[model samples]
Target: MSLSPAFLDELRARTSLSALIGKTTKLQKAGREFRGCCPFHNEKTPSFYVNDDKGFYHCFGCSAHGDAIRWMTDQRGLPFIDAVKELAQSAGLEMPATDPRAAKKAERQKGLHEAMEDAAAFFTEQLHGIAGADARAVLEKRGISAETARTFGFGFAPDARNRLRTALKSYGDAMLVEAGLLIQVEGKEPYDRFRGRLMIPIRDPRGRVIAFGGRIIGDGEPKYLNSPDTPLFDKGRTLYNLDRAAPASRKSARAIVVEGYMDVVALAQAGIGEAVAPLGTALTEAQLERLWRMVDVPIVCLDGDAAGQKAAMRAAHRALPMLAPGKSLAFVTLPDGQDPDDLVRSKGAAPMEKLLAETQPLVDRLWQAELAAEPLDTPEQRAGLKQRLADLIRPITDASVKYEYQAEFRRRFDAHFSPQRRPFVPFEKRTGGKRPAGRSGWQPALPVTEDAKKVHAAGIDRVLAKAVLAGLIRHPAEIARHMEVLGSLRLADGALGRLFEAVVDLAVEEQALDSTRLVTILARSGLGDVAGELLRADTMPYSFTQKSADPVRAQADLDEAIAILVARPEVDMMLADATSAMQSRFTDDAFERQVALVREKQALELRLANLVQANEDARALGPEEN
Candidate 1:
């Protein structure tokens, strides 16, 4: 639920920005403001200044300046709502519900939070109080120090029925069931799912316990067992140790992503504190994108075994296209047959530190890994490897970075696979005018049909509407140029339209829109794809260096694209059928037929004009065209 501007203003006034930020960074009295090194970026100079009177702070060095909320958002790398929630918690203030649905969702989240807190306390008690000696011994045997165990809130669940059920009696049986802390049995009773294990509480970025990760204390089928999906926890959506790592990320300006919870814990314990791990999943695009926001670079730490190597390679492949020139990755490989936990235990924190210090850049590691595989002796292998390298490099929009990678790929490909005399044969067939001289009409290697195009176009439109709304709302001047276009068009009627409406409404009410509020909206609207598309579209603001930057020019370009789409031969055929149907409805109106023809002619004329404008060498339109 969105707070009123007046309410937000009041909340901002109530909280002391200087005091809140002073707790983290050492601030000194300047003339009229407090000054300190920026917390959000690495800097030696005292560029970050906070003006208590203005309720704002600015970093002259980095230009990271904003209001109190923006300051917290920058510092924590959290969404605005998350930052507001953080600040509200600190102030012991409740968020006023602005809508009924939001109020209900908030109520559900509070229940889940309470359940998780209860489960954590119960598990913690079990570790120390009774029937947890065996689990403690297992930790000792694994070389986990008592201090380390306490630091991570390590615990165990007894191998018995209703342990957590009895512990969380206040929240109700439904709470425990929903929280995935207890599993119901048909005849007997509900039992704790994470019994006979060393517990690792999976906290959110706010440090609230959302789920648990358990390591087998005894001989068990699965080495690690995690809490099942609940209203609060989705393993894929979270990063282990994000609570601790996020602050470190903001300070250090980088984060290290590892393969396991142990890797994250061990690294943090080892003083490589800015480390997090994906919860029992591959390093996803979503996880990577989120990490990039928190840190300038995210080093991927993978295991040394075959599976680890594969995981690392997969991460590198996923990350390459997203890598900007300034952004980067490093690969950390633990010793053979060892994970980060084991390495830290056997070799101590110093060795782990040394490993991080000696980590290889992702590009170097990826190149070495690719080259380490079977020889480029065969033509097929050479072609396959070259294609694989190209697939990884082409999506990056940065020309300099792409060019560097392209040159590096070509050099490496030549060094590894190229025969001394024979030229490398292209993998994909060339098409269009570039095709072999004897070839007839250029056919798409993979032609998307009209049905596919319609579906894809709808998806693209959903993404476009969300993106355009976000852009236009942020830049008010854009509203006049784009609103009519947005209003005239029809998108796929569903959750996406609802979300677009919500954003537009928010913009209308607040005169500014917060992207975070849209998150819950998008999630509720069942528009995850649209949300993901919006999140993933890393659009750089257009600079008015070209004619395309003008609103008229840009819209004209868009209109042309739309006109061409409407005037497609397939579309023309479809329009003919539509017109015939309309004719039947009209009964006997020759004027209707003429009017339809005239509209079609106008559309064709627009398409022709666009073609001519876009391509100066295009043919001219005559009076007959009208």
Candidate 2:
């Protein structure tokens, strides 16, 4: 769905940026803006700056800045729809449905959430009623305390089909089906999915009941009955105990991810308040992002079994690219055949706490595990291991973490593995045949792409967007000048342009607007990063003169910039190709026809290059030069 100016206007009018961001991270006044360490990226020094009066935040460290909607989407890992919904909720503003489809989705989500809540209440009542004795006995055997069960909202699903089905009949069969309370029979009635089991209500990080997990009391075919995939509940996306653990996770600057409902409950019960687990599913990016939102360091607490260790490794591998600087992961090994639940019950909270504190870094675990499995004594084995290590480390994009592992590998292998060895005769070594640089005779090149450069240049539209926005705020009359420039470009119709329009509308309303307020309003609209990039893009020289600290220095810088732009051979070549294609439009000479759209884009780039150069020269010569 497109982000419209009207939606942004509604969002800005309703919500306060400080209240929204302040709830997650501690913010303090720094000049006119509020400063806090970024919640998206780990940082010891504050880089997340929020201008309360302006209503915008920018993270200089990670380059993650956006309005409240954008912040909620990026920081809380919520989908765009959910992010808007959350902001609307915070503002006590009911977001109007843009379409019937959105309304239907919302209705389904609401019904499922409501059903889950009702089901939880039903199970809780049962736990205190007829099924209470059996469930409590099981908890006692598992060494779970009364307080622990209460804290986790533990319940019991009676062996009857009509128990919750009867209680929630008013919600209708569709709701029951969505909530996974009843399994459908072809051309017949629905039957209870979870019966004769202890019910565990699974909640999202916001403490909203979205689903249920039921563990059978005794011998059963399928051990657990999890809620079906519903609008509100996605097993892969939801983390068990996230709601209870997130506040603590933020406070501690760390979170522990376990594998089961019991593990999370046991950890929390045993005083490990920062522990959470994925709901009846493998770790997913959604869950990882959620964990990322809460804390800087997220520890993967795996059970000491083969399957569990494998799962932890998979999770770490998946998380590698998304792992920003300062964010860390550790692997904690419980005793063999023991999970958090078993360990906490057997050894108490202190041992579990110690294990968490003493968990090994994920990278260290990987290297240690790799070396232990491979016979690295022989030169061939060592060399193979080195390549394997490099291959494993290649996917790790985080420079700091990747380099740390590289340094560790160097330290471990330098003495023996550093020396070059050959399989052929010693005489062949004199021929100077060394292994080809990079992996498998094919290595991906760095230093950006032509497309990336195009995209970066396309980013100039963003600068103009910011200019249009800033101009509208400062001198509403100047907005027409900026828009005229923008109109000539036919900038891509998307979030950036929509935001520019929103700023213009606001400027029209305010008469004289503040840039920070515009930024804040833009931030609330959920395009903070795009707006920030636009605002932070290259400053034009005459514009600087208009806000003059010094026009002469600006002019000199502008001239140098233009010279640099003109010297780009690649850009010039691209521009020449574009202009030739444009000229071809008038001729019927069977020429090497340039692709129409690509040619126009290239021509635009050429025009931009010339414009930049001319602007630079004009700035260097002062206002009289124009």
Off by over 4 Å in 2: 1-105, 399-401, 415-626
Q: Against the true structure, what is each candidate's TM-score?
A: 0.54, 0.55
Cα lDDT tens digits for candidate 1, 1-626: 74654456667877888998899899999854799999878999899999764578888988988877987787768899988888888877788767986666656668888888877777888899668999888777776678878888988887877777887788776677778888877786666777778789999765889899988877977999999998778877788988888767756666888788777777777777888988888888878877876765677778889898899888888887688877877888878877887788777888877787887887888777766665766778776676666656656655456545655665565444422333323323323333354333333222334743564455333333444544443343444444555455555677666656655554555544444554555567576566556555445222111222324333333444443433444444444444545444422243344345445544554444433332221111111210
Give the per-residue lDDT of model 2 (tens digit) for 1-626. Answer: 44444455568657778888899899998744688898888889988888553456888998887788888887788998889877877777766746776656656666777788888988999998966788878888887788988888899999987778888899998778877788898898897888899999888645788788899888886787788887667787788887778667645667899988888877777777888887656788888877766666688987889989888888877887677777767888888888988888888888888887897877787777778767877778877886777666666665456545554665565534433432333322545775434423321112235754664455333443444344344334444434444343334578766776676666557655556677787788787777676545447422322343233333333333333333343343454454444443422121222233233444445434443443453345344322
Candidate 2 has what TM-score? 0.55
How much does candidate 1 score in TM-score? Answer: 0.54
Top TM-score prediction, candidate number = 2
Evaluate model 1: give its lDDT.
0.67
| Model 2 lDDT-worst window of ten | 586-595
In candidate 1, which residue pairs clash?
A: none
